[model samples]
Target: MKSEPVAGVRPEVKRRAEQGSQQLQGEVQKLELENLLRTKFPFDAIEPVPKGEFGGDVLHRVVGAGGQSGGTILWEFNRTKNWSDAWLAKLRDDQRTAKAEIAVIVSQSLPKDVETFEMVEGVWVTHPRAALPVAMIFRLSLLEVALARQSTEGQQTKTEMVYQYLTGPRFRQRVEAIVEAFSTMQEDLDKERKAIMKQWAKREEQIERVMGATVGMYGDLQGIAGKPLQEIEGLSLQALDAPVVNNRSAAE
Candidate 1:
């Protein structure tokens, strides 16, 4: 016979197991949402708050080009329960602690009125499927506002430069002129390379001509030396043969 589970032990174990599973799911959701936000807004600063922190799950700070913080967005993740007013209140309190300009909840279960995202008591509620777009909208808005404030605070020169480079005809004309100069320089380099190659060919022809003339002169000298040597040998032989009779006749 199979033994039955203990009276309170089984229920407690089941409750703990369920609680652990929910916690795991919630953590996973938080990580996924954080990764999505980070990828979508790489220029912004993303910070994941520690567990039991006074603020929300993630904090996004709008960072300017100069590495200054502008606006903050507090993000919360809820997977176990449906969207409720209590969560909104909690987000509001967390926002104050986080010093955030916007508060959002990325939940698995959205409220009845919210198909994707809607403002519920000033807190933005978004489902997981629409998290990226919703977060992007908030991040871009905050960035625009931050940049505007920065521009008013004597940081307009760089912004003006970017604008002019993007839209000014003079900047385009300067770029075109630089490109044309580079093209002309490349063409001149090609022409110089061709001229050098031609010079090398002419030098090679002159070298070949000189080598041919040297070889011909050497052959002519060899021929002239051979003829004189042959003539000397012939005279020596003829004198050897007739010399004995001549000497005797002279003496007589």
Candidate 2:
């Protein structure tokens, strides 16, 4: 069945609402990425790009002490409802402007061909949660490339083999495996969390139901036995309400 626009709602209002939501979601993902890169990731330096800059949103670097290690990874995060082809072109341009060797776009929406992550038009496109694994792979690639450069003088064939492996489909498979594992773990955690919450809610309802029955039974005993009925501590509200009743009597 086809759905129509919400009754009596302006299209402009809906558009603004969606834009606001997307902006908020993007901010949250950006903050999370910052924390992971700063604390957990192996990047030697992490830099946040300023707004309206002609570069990527974040710049990450792996620096080795006067050794074979120097590369920059550019990152862009998006949370829009749909994927935009323009994003890939723009990030590529930003990658060049920032002189980053690897450019990654972490978006909520992926291109039709991409499921978890993929190299599209020379740029990496991935789900926001899978961004770390992608970054790690690229980070390792940079480190390995550095090592390869140092060793290539003596073993050119071996270095070329390593380079070939890094760029091959096998490398992409490894990334997909890591991303799939992380995504599965996250999905399981969410399910467990929701199940536990549902259980708590059900238990609360049962408790409330039992209390209601108990209170009703107490009231019935009072009606049947009149003054001879014993008052239950928590269930009997008459004693507490007696003073209010007497005050009203006095007022009358």
Candidate 3:
């Protein structure tokens, strides 16, 4: 029997659905990784909590490699644009009250080009690196809220200032100077690692060449020593260098 023609879906619709699904999955994965990183490295810095989780408002900057006293201060804003003027004033006051030495901004609205705090350039800034503000800000605010809970013990339900510090411009400048110096140092280290790799590669090539030459010579000697010509030459044999020195091939 002839059946009615079924409605067909457009290629564009399928593509869009796939793209949206991929985006949602990526966001979910990012949040999970951020949470895992935060949990494992909690004491180091105030990492952004996953969306729909607590501690989205508090931003934590690492002191050093997840180990050290007096870790840097971190802060995040609230989503929903629900922050009251009074609360903001209180946060400003807290910023003054906490008297933190360094401030790290990890907002989703922040530009990727931002390396460090505007007030202090040495400090590293780690925004969500996402192009969407609403999502990033929401995540940042979520982290902020999480941090606030820890600081205030859930006494203040709504978002409030987590910390504030009164420090001199010199301190900010020092932080910037340190960050700049650290950047330079990291560059130097990378260059050194590459250089070392190159040198090792060269040495490895030389060792392989010498080993090949020795194998050829050994085959010639073995032929003279009455070994089967085919057996001596066809085997994958490697001969050691003179001085019987230990060969540290980069390949090894």
Per-candidate TM-score against the hidden true structure: 0.55, 0.53, 0.28
Please say which candidate is ahead in lDDT: 1 or 2: 2
Each model's lDDT comes to: 0.77, 0.80, 0.48
Displacement of residue 6 (Cα, Å) in model 1 is: 3.1
Candidate whose lDDT is highest:
2
Ranking by TM-score: 1, 2, 3
Arranged by lDDT with the best first, the candidates are 2, 1, 3
Q: Candidate 2 lDDT (Cα, whole model)? A: 0.80
- Over the stretch 8-63, how does candidate 1's per-residue lDDT look in tens digits? 99889999999999999899889988888788777888999867878588888887
The lDDT, on a scale of 0 to 1, for candidate 1 is 0.77
Write candidate 2's Cα lDDT for 162-239 as tens digits: 887698644654565567569989999999999999999999999999988988888888999999987787676765
Clash tally for model 2: 0
Which sections of candidate 1 miss by over 4 Å?
Answer: 7-12, 51-53, 65-68, 154-252
Q: How accurate locally is residue 156 in candidate 2, as Cα lDDT from 0 to 100?
A: 61
Model 1: how far is 229 from its true place, Å? 99
Estimate, for each residue in 134-211, the C-alpha lDDT of model 3 and write its tens digit. 333434544554455456654653333223211443445446556756998999999999999999999999988987
Whose TM-score is higher: candidate 1's or candidate 2's?
Answer: 1
